[model samples]
Target: MMRAFKSLFWIEFKLSVRAMNLVLFGLFSPAVVAVIIGVIYGAKPAFDGAGYSFMAQSFGALSGIGICATGLMGLPLALADYRHRKILKRFEVTPVSPGMLLFVQVAVNFVYALAAMAMVYGICRMFGGGWEGGSFLYFGLSFLLVTVSIYSLGMLVASVAGNIKTANLLCTVLYFPMLIFSGATLPYEVMPPALQHVADIMPLTQGVKLMKNAALGLPIENAAVPVAVMVILAVICVVVSIRFFRWE
Candidate 1:
């Protein structure tokens, strides 16, 4: 089983890489966005009275771009399309289980998101004034929580969507709003009061807030809301995904 899983994972990894458009986007889009924002805003205050610069405040949000792209869209879409085509059904007769296929898809998408995140951090360190966080450890914890939450949510999407078309529609509905308004692609600090109120209710927005607070070395207690929200979201999504998972 271990050997079969390894072989399956390798095949999926190669397939993920072959989709160069998506692979490149996931790997470098965050760095590209970072360059544009860093050039425009530099060390300027993110907003009036905000202690951090725009670049610093945006680092956490920028890191989430690939998460939305892969975890929220790519992962679920790939899994659903496979199911729609009966690829998973073939695995049912083999030693490989449906759970193994799901795991491989999740692993592939997680790799992309992790690579993008690392690139974002490296670019930020080079040109985005670096982070003020006193400890990467706590920031790592925050990143882990956000990643798990988003991917678990993606798993739920795969479990529920009956076909590629449905998955695509669902992803569009969820991804665009999160990508546009969750501060992943925009400056959340400058958003209007009403929009900020709405955006704050989003899990990704809360995750970004959790990340930002950690990056700023702010007291962890200050991020109680986002932390709890992401934790609950991850748990609920994972449970639901497992309960409703479909091989067909």
Candidate 2:
């Protein structure tokens, strides 16, 4: 079973590499944006009492972007394509299960998302914008929670989508709004009060806030709400996806 999983994972990884859009958006784009932001603001000093530099905040936000791109966009599209092509149906007659294929897809995309985050962090550090946080453990936990929650949402989309085209459309509809309001694409500070309230309700917004605070080494206040939200969201989505998943 382990060997079968390994084979499926490698195959999925290779297929992902061959998909130029996935490579571009899921992997390279965040790194590119980090480099650009670092070059532009690398010299700026940390904001008053903000603990970390502006570049760190930007990188933190960009990390969420990469996570969202892979978890919310790439994963669903790939899984939907598999369903559309009847790949999942074909797996049912073999020793390998469709559940294993889904696992492999999730594992491979999680790696991609982490690699993208690492690449963005490296670029930021190379440009003199390394993280100023003190607690690696806390940051790791926050990152894990955000990634799992977001990926669960993707899984929900894959389980419910009827075809690749619908998956892509749904992902797009979710992606742009999350990107815009979550401060991944736009600065959250500059958003109007009403808009900020709306953004506050978004899961990614809370994720980004948690990540930014963790990255900045700031004491996370009122964190219970976001943490609970993400945990609940992940659990519910995973349960629903598993219960209603379609192999064909």
Candidate 3:
């Protein structure tokens, strides 16, 4: 089992690396955005010494983009392609179980997510000052939570999509709106109150808020609602995906 798992993991990892478009948007996009934001706001003071430095906040927000790109776009498309091509069905009779395939994909994509986050963090630290509001541990944990939550949503997407075309369509529908309204592409503070409320209901918005608060080292009292929302969303999506997922 261990050997099979290891082989599956490496195969998935290789396929992920070969996916140039996913690599570009999922990993490099965040890094590029961080560099741009850092250059624009590198001189700004920390927000009254109570909020994140502008660079830090930008990094936190763009991190969500990476997560969304991977979970919302990359994972679904790849998995759907496998199903469409009947690859999962072929694996059913082998020592490598369909569940193992799912595990390998999730694990590989997770590594991509982490690498993307790290790249964004490194870029921001180089151009702006390093994270000024929270301890490394706090920020890391928040990032991990947000990634898992988004990845769960991706699994749900893959579960329902019956073909590659459907997966891509669904991802497109979910991806653009979430990216635009979830405070990933726009600063939340400047949004209109109505739009802010709408954004608040989005899973990625909650994730972004959690990450930004952690980056700023803000008091957790105001962050409790988003934290709860993210946790619940993660749990619900994971359960639903597992229950409904089709290997063939």
Candidate 4:
């Protein structure tokens, strides 16, 4: 099973790179948005008295958002295309299991999301950003949890979607509502009570919360709920994705 999974991972990774649209869409969009937001917010601290750098927070938020976006949107689209092409069906005929395929897809996307995160963090640091001490473990785990959760959701999307176009459309429609309300673009504190209630249920919002806590070197207790939510969502997604996944 381990060997099968590794083989599938390489195959999916190659396919991901070959699909230039997915690569560009995943890599560039959030980068552009992060740059714009980071530049604007990083220019001046929201309150000079707070002794906080707004760019650091913005960068952290951007990293979480970027990872979630790629894991959720880009991954599903690629898998949908594979399903549409009968690639999944072809694999079904082989000794490789659906579980292997799904795991590979998730693993490959996690790596991509991590790479994107590294790029974002590097860019921020190059521009004079700094991190609070004692946050490395929290940040690492939060990022890992969020990435895995969203990657599983993308697999769920691939399982349910009929084709690449439908999957792309569904992912797009689902993305903004979640993203906007997820505290990535707008502060959760600024949201109305109803909206905040809605955002609280969203995985992306939980992701943002985790990222922020990590960036601030806050205690892990502050991140416990979000981490739990992400884990639950990931489990649900993986189970449902397997239950409904179609070979052809």
User: Which candidate number has the best TM-score?
Assistant: 2
Clashing pairs in 1: none
Off by over 4 Å in 4: 220-222
Q: What's model 4's TM-score?
A: 0.89
TM-score of each: 0.90, 0.94, 0.91, 0.89
Clashes of each: 0, 0, 0, 0
Candidate 1 deviant stretches above 4 angstroms: 45-52
- Best-to-worst order by TM-score is 2, 3, 1, 4
Candidate 3 structure quality by residue, lDDT tens digits, 156-229: 88877888888898989888999999998789888999999988888888888777777767755566777777
- Output the number of the lDDT-best candidate: 2
Candidate models: Cα lDDT each: 0.81, 0.84, 0.80, 0.74
Inter-residue clash pairs, candidate 2: none
Order the candidate numbers by lDDT, best to worst.
2, 1, 3, 4
lDDT by residue for model 2 over 1-248, one digit each (tens)? 99989988898899888887668998998888887787778847656675457787776788888889988898888989989999878876888754566568789888988998899889878877768754678778888898889888898899889988889889998888998899886879889999999999888898888787777777899999999999999999888887788887
**Which one wins by lDDT: 1 or 2?**
2
For residues 1-248, write the lDDT of model 1, one tens digit per residue.
88888898899889877867448666777779988888888878777897777777777888888888888888888888889999877877888765677677778887888888888777776665558754688778877888888888888999888888889898889888998999898878679999999998888887877777778877666577777888898889888887788888
Q: Model 3 segments beyond 4 Å from truth?
A: 46-52
- Tell me the deviation in Å of residue 229 in model 2: 0.8
